[model samples]
Target: MTASLPVATQQDGTYPRPQLMRGAWHPLDGQWDFAFRDDPREAPAGVDFDDTIVVPFPPESPASGIGDTGYHLVAWYRRRVTAEDIADAGAAGTGARVMIRFGAVDWAADVWVNGTHLGSHTGGQTPFSIDATDVLDRDGDNELVVRAVDDPHDVAVLRGKQDWLEEPHAIWYHRTTGIWQPVWLEVVPETHVESLAWSSDVPNGSVTLELTLDARPADELDATVELRIAGELLARTNVRLLDRTTEITLHLARQRNGQQYEHLLWNPETPRLIDATITLGRGASEVDAVSSYLGLRSVQATDRRFLLNGRPLYLRSVLAQNYWPESHLAAPDAAALRREVQLILDLGFNAARVHQKAEDPRFLYWADRLGLMIWGETASAYEFSERAIAALTTEWMALVRRDRSHPSIVAWVPLNESWGVQHIASDARQQAFSRSISDLTRSLDGSRPVISNDGWEHAGSDIWTVHDYEADPEILAHRYGSTAAITELFDGFGPAGRRISVGQQDGGQPVMLTEFGGVSYIDQDVEGAWGYSSASDAQDFARRVGGIVGAVRAATPLAGFCYTQLTDTGQETNGLVRADRSPKIPIEDLRRIIAGD
Candidate 1:
């Protein structure tokens, strides 16, 4: 036996960070005994294999130690854990509860812990969590089994850009399935804070906090939520809404912290957040408490400019696809995610459009911690309708519920370039469907901005988003200068030309070159064209692409720009790095142009 596989080491390699911790109970994500079975029903009884792979990282990814291979269809992962790992998690003296968390699993996954079958989940994108306090063995090792069936090639299920074709062609995309995220168990107190959500009505001079708590119904607990600035109380409220959902409002008077106030606000330049504490008490006896963070920033359109913290914040952003060559859609490790984010920040960009796929929860978690704004998006194929719409809407709503609290996410993009919409249909039906989905997203999350269709067609959206591919810079500078504030510039192929029919000004609006600079692919092993067309190569990939990026940077009229990609996917070599994560161009070179160095 290879001893019990070791737990995952944090960046510092000292303590274990639970997949997502609320209090004391930490999750077991580092090691799991696994077996690749031809069929799902044939999974063995216990941790009975020498072959061990790290949990969370997909088996196909190089980081998982399984190396790169397309062999898995249905694989099983098993491990044994102890209850003692989560005994004292909440604050210090609070009662404990254990919960299981999955960062993400592709297609579907079936979980069984301690011989009791838990349940299954579909959809390759969002994260899921479950309470496992009941099945935990206090003094003995408990069993954990996961049956992962990923059809990375499945055409029917929402596979995003993952192509079923063995040889990726056109814009079909790379395949990533199975447990692509970390899985662990968390311990919490009997009466404790489950999660903290914040909404800043900056113009209203107030911030509202929605607190979700998990505790026993019989216990009558006094809850006091306090918001402080620089170690002094700014707003304190005692509420009796324990044992159920509760809302607390804190109004600011001159931005003071009970004593002396500072006029400091959160912005892209200096993203400021306050540390808050939730205290649960029975009269004077403090039963439980938890620590949380929140940012006071707002993203919206004002006088034809996107404002951040009441200033016209120009977003020189890029479309970043979180995929490493050896790992595919998975990052080599959490540090890799941080490194990429830092690269963007170092480039002097304020935001990233997390294009196509829903990134790892930890990625978003760090985005919040590091203060990078995001245009969170979902993956859609070249199809559309009520069924697809329903699925997309359901998944997006769940995504918002899980990630809305994060300060990094500023916008939600449901459809991109009509990837999943049937564009062949009449414009009326297309517009109606597009508008419907956009409206649905708005109704669900009214706090952040929503982009209906990211490319040529503007069915309806809060931002006049576009994607342009024109080589000439003058077209955007002078051709279309009098339009809505949300104009998006694509390869000029979709609706811009048609929308400006019969001699009308194309009002440049807040001209954002949403898509451009797909400089083509030139990896020795893989040869392919850029997604939309064929106009680039490996020899000239960097210079040609860098020329375009530099051109956009020099063009001051453009509000923002999003290069076609951050990393290359299979067959698509336009990324700054090769599909396997090897940098195509030197980092210092890209940094020079990105940072205007």
Candidate 2:
């Protein structure tokens, strides 16, 4: 019989310094007892604990220690945390409530601690946090069990690139099962800061700060928020909390009092973020303090161009899918995610259109820390049942709730070109789901803009996002004021000879070459044959991407663009870089075109 891995038994279980968390995160991502069953109802009793597997990484992943025997099944994770852990947390001033946070779990999960059921959640892409203070065994070891179920057959849920067909082909892969995200516990003071929200009104040179606090009736429960410009204080405000939520507005008076006028406003070239510190309390006797920040920028489209902070700013972006063979959805470490960000920065791109799904929180944390603009999207690209729809809607709301604190995410795309949404002509269920997703995202997250659909089939979004795959860049430039190429290679060729057509196309909107390059998998020398076309060489891919950059730049009407992809995904090899994150082509090739050479 295989021995089960020992769970960390310290005062605090284990805190892996996740490369992506803005602050500190206790990583509950280590080994835990796992079991897989054909029917979730036929769960094994606790006495049969030997049938367990690992937590976070799906049973199919190599990291999960279960070989590719292929168990497309449902299971539960069981572990025990002592009351001593909770007591230690309570002793610390930061401790008030212990919440179990899941980075992500596949399909659906229902959690219970110490025999008390917390709640159930669905949607595989977003994070979910639940308060486990009351449910814990305060005096002894507490049993924690997470039951998760994923039906690969269910198409209505948002399952990005995951395939139920076992073998991943073309652009899909084996579905991730069970908890795939960092699971840990955090202790918050009973009267701690619950959430933070920010809005950037660059035109008026002002920002509104919204703080949600725990219900605590202290004599002076006013929250003080201080704003800083490049480590220097610009403005500060103190507002009284009324029912756990309060909004305070701050105006940045004239470009940091005498610095260069251009230096004051945050521009694309020199993007700036105003840091903030929120303190809850009366004078020195503060109850809690949370560090947060916001950017002085806005994303909108005008007759002149896609405006950032009311100024015409071009979006030289890249389509970034947060996936790695070794790590799958989760990054190996925060540094790994940071390295991905550095790769984009090195590629001369300014923004990342987080393709199909929302990324790890740490990825967003790094984006905020690194000044990278992000388009935060929901995993809404699958077709599922009515039960799945209801479950997904709850998951989407929680996703926005957990992520609304980050400022790096400037826009939100809830649905993508209708991946799982299906045929728009006759599916009323799909249309309703699309509309419902848009409404939920908009209502939950009002701080940033939301896109109902990323590529095609616009439901209701701030921008009319259009996806095009024409041979002519100029013709695309005339149409969809801002067009994005969801398919990286147009007409199946590289960047060198791609055309720049003129006249009206795509409804005459600004053009954004969103997706162009794709999978240059690491084993390209061995597996680089393009079945669709004969001209599938590294040079061909390079030439195609290089040409599009030139064509778009040459055609001044093009607002901004994104390459086909940041890395080769599965079998769709056209990336400037390989799937293993090794550079397939030189960065100079892309630099030259982005520089308009």
Whole-model lDDT values for every prediction: 0.65, 0.62
What would the per-residue lDDT of candidate 2 be over residues 71-161, giving only the tens digit for each residue? 4667678887766655544334544678777777887788888677788777787666788887676678887888888877776677777
Candidate 2: regions farther than 4 A off = 1-25, 42-47, 51-55, 67-71, 82-95, 135-140, 216-220, 253-268, 282-284, 384-392, 426-450, 459-464, 468-509, 517-536, 594-597
Clashes of 1: 24
Score every model by TM-score: 0.84, 0.82
lDDT, candidate 1, at 175: 70
Error of 1 at 432 (Å): 3.7
Among these predicted structures, which one has the highest lDDT?
A: 1
lDDT at 146, model 2: 86
